[model samples]
Target: MTDLLETVIENREMVQPNHANMLETAHGGHVMKWMDEVGAMSAMRFSGETCVTARVDQMNFERPIAVGDTAFITAYVYEAGTSSVKVRLIAEREDLRTREREQTTESYFVYVAIDEDSSPTTVPELTVSTEEGEQLRRAALENEAE
Candidate 1:
């Protein structure tokens, strides 16, 4: 089993004009790209194999992030199956001027591990070691709701 805390990963990107929409806010597609990239990284790190997104359980965009703000994306592997890893992802926007941050979006993504030949690959079990890990696991369970 692998400790899910050990699989937590974070990535950051500055929102550029090209990443903005007609409203001058960061485009939802661009944000989803960032989330998918970070989530894949977390899944690969947890599974030690290539990963492909199986499902985006939920994606909620709470606020808009304007161009020039830094998008901070954090992801962690919270659950695992024979070949699937459940990841929790959070995206926050940091105000460069005030140094304040606001969560802009959140989602739960499921990824399936794949072998070199692109076949489904088994993944190690997930271990929850700390209070935060337990909390995330519980949250993932609640988020599943089925």
Candidate 2:
């Protein structure tokens, strides 16, 4: 089994005007897309197979990111079932000039591995090896409560 902490993956995207809403803030849909992509990548890394999103739990937009900010998205597998992987995702915004960062969104997403036939496939067990991994797992569980 792969250590989930070591299997974590990250992705980033810049918030441009096209990715913003009329309010000039990052669009909710865009954030969701970014989260899903990062979460999927983590799941794939953990499973070593193609994966598809099965569900997204409690995605909360905590803050607004303005255009020109960079969105840093991180995803890690925290738990696993027979064919499912639960990923924790966080999106943070980095100011272009000041380089300040603030977490703008958080979510828990579930994905299922698929075989070449596109059927559900089993995945290796997830192992949390470090304090940071344990902390993220705890935070994900806590966020699920809210």
Candidate 3:
């Protein structure tokens, strides 16, 4: 079994001009792609198999990451199915100078583990051992319920 906290992944991406739109804010597509990549990594860490994005749910862009800012992406597998892992993701806009961060986007992504033949593969059940892990699971479940 994989613990929720063990599957958590956090990464940062500098928002270059190419990553931004005409408004000088990070592009939605670029942000989505980054989240997908991070979510897949989180799922693979738990499943021990190659994973691909299967679905994205409730994606909301609450704010934008401006050019020259750092985008902090966080992902974690909160639950598992026969072959699918449910991941919770968050993106925050960070100002390195002031060390302030505001959440820019949030979403849930589902990934399915695949075998060498590209067939869906089974994954171990998810476990929540620590308080932090349990808290993440509960928050994700509650958001899912909404």
Q: Pick the candidate with the highest lDDT.
A: 3
Estimated TM-score for each candidate: 0.94, 0.95, 0.98
Candidate 2 residue-wise lDDT at 70: 90
Which clashing pairs does model 3 show? none
lDDT of 1 by residue, 73-96 (tens): 999998898999999988999987
Candidate 3, residues 24-130, lDDT tens digits: the string is 99999999999999999999999999999889888999999999999999999998999999999999999999999999999999999999999999999999999
- True-structure RMSD, every candidate: 1.5, 1.1, 0.7
Which residue pairs in candidate 1 collide? none
Off by over 4 Å in 1: 144-146
Candidate 2 — worst ten consecutive residues by lDDT sum?
Answer: 3-12
| Number of residue pairs clashing in candidate 3, backbone atoms closer than 3 angstroms, sequence gap of 3 or more or interchain | 0
Once model 1 is optimally superposed onto the true structure by TM-score, how far is the C-alpha of residue 53 displaced, in angstroms? 1.0
Model 1 Cα shift for residue 7 (angstroms): 1.1
Mark the 10 consecutive residues where model 1 has the least summed lDDT.
137-146
Q: How displaced is residue 117 in candidate 2, in Å?
A: 0.8
Residue-level lDDT of model 2, residues 31-136, one tens digit each, is: 9999999899999989999999999987989999889889989998888999999998999998868978899999999999999999999999888888988888
Best by TM-score: 3
